[model samples]
Target: MRPLIAIPARFSARTSALRYAAEVNARSLIEAVWRAGGEPVGIHPADTGTAARLARFDGVLLPGGGDLAPPATAPPTPTTPSTTSTPSRTPSTSTSPGTPWSRACPCSRSAAASRP
Candidate 1:
């Protein structure tokens, strides 16, 4: 069986076909996972039962969108580059051990290849 990947959907104010608000996962992102032989599951972005749900999946693909809410105590920072001169890199935010988000695989250049 292919690995089941959990991709949390983001809220869209509207979708072309839907009359009301909608939850959406990126089509291209879903296609990429499918092409790579993984099952992409679109899940509601809820705060409860996260760890249990994540434990059921083989891998996770954090979708391209806004950053996850910063740790409550810290001030907000721009995730984007301030100037073109500076090199671009995604900053890592540390989380506590045994948390669901911490279970996500680190995507280093060497680890770009997704696995089940």
Candidate 2:
């Protein structure tokens, strides 16, 4: 059996397919996962019963969209400004010991430096 990948569908104000605005996931993303031998499952972005629902899936894909709430603590400033620019690199994936399966996609190359 293919690994089940739970993808949270984003809420869209308007879409071409439906008569009215609806919650949706990108078709390209779904197809890509399927092509890669994983079953993509669209998950409702609700808090109720989420843990139970997610427990059934082998992995979760948190696609980019929506506004992120500001962190409780203030963001830190860079100690030294970068003088040279480097080519953008893909984010590395790592799993924590004894934790649920998870992946990280860096929004920017400087994402690590911004962490307090």
Candidate 3:
């Protein structure tokens, strides 16, 4: 069967927080999908029903953007830090499980860490 794909907008009327992405948006990705020989569908913000729609599509692609202001929680506690602590400079092996290029969830990390 022909591949069916859906891309949701990064922001909409319902969006409460400011956007952070400086690069391409969902629309461009949709165009890329068309160029790649797949069907692309755009999703609306208020349409919570898209969940059902997404299920119908062969795949769902959530494009990149700002960090969603998920509910705040207590910060991680720092303990026993001398000089060995260091952030991994290596990129994630894969972000998504099923897609060709595994896409890491946008909310998973801050923009600084993931940028190329």
Q: What is the C-alpha RMSD of each candidate to the true structure, in Å?
A: 7.7, 9.8, 10.8
Better of 2 and 3 by lDDT: 2
Better-scoring candidate (TM-score), 2 or 3: 2
| lDDT (10s digit) by residue, model 1, range 20-88 | 999999897787777677788898999888888887776667764456443332344575333322312
Clashes of each: 0, 0, 5
What local lDDT score does residue 31 receive in model 3, on the 0 to 100 scale? 60
Would you list the clashing residue pairs of candidate 3? 95-102, 95-103, 95-104, 96-102, 96-103
Q: How close is candidate 2 to the true structure, as a TM-score?
A: 0.59
Q: Write candidate 3's Cα lDDT for 10-111 as tens digits.
A: 444343264543322455566666655557666654455554556566555555445632222112236423232222223344523443324332322333
| Model 3 lowest lDDT segment of ten | 68-77
For candidate 2, the 10 contiguous residues with the lowest summed lDDT are: 80-89
Highest-TM-score candidate = 1
Stretch of 10 with least lDDT, candidate 1:
82-91
Q: How well does candidate 1 score on lDDT at residue 82?
A: 39
Candidate 2 C-alpha lDDT tens digits along 1-116: 88787889888888997778787999876766666566888988897877677777776666665464223112332643332222112336444433333333322223334445
Q: Which of 1 and 3 is ahead in lDDT?
A: 1
Comparing 1 and 3 by TM-score, which wins? 1
After superposition, candidate 1 runs with Cα above 4 Å error = 68-116
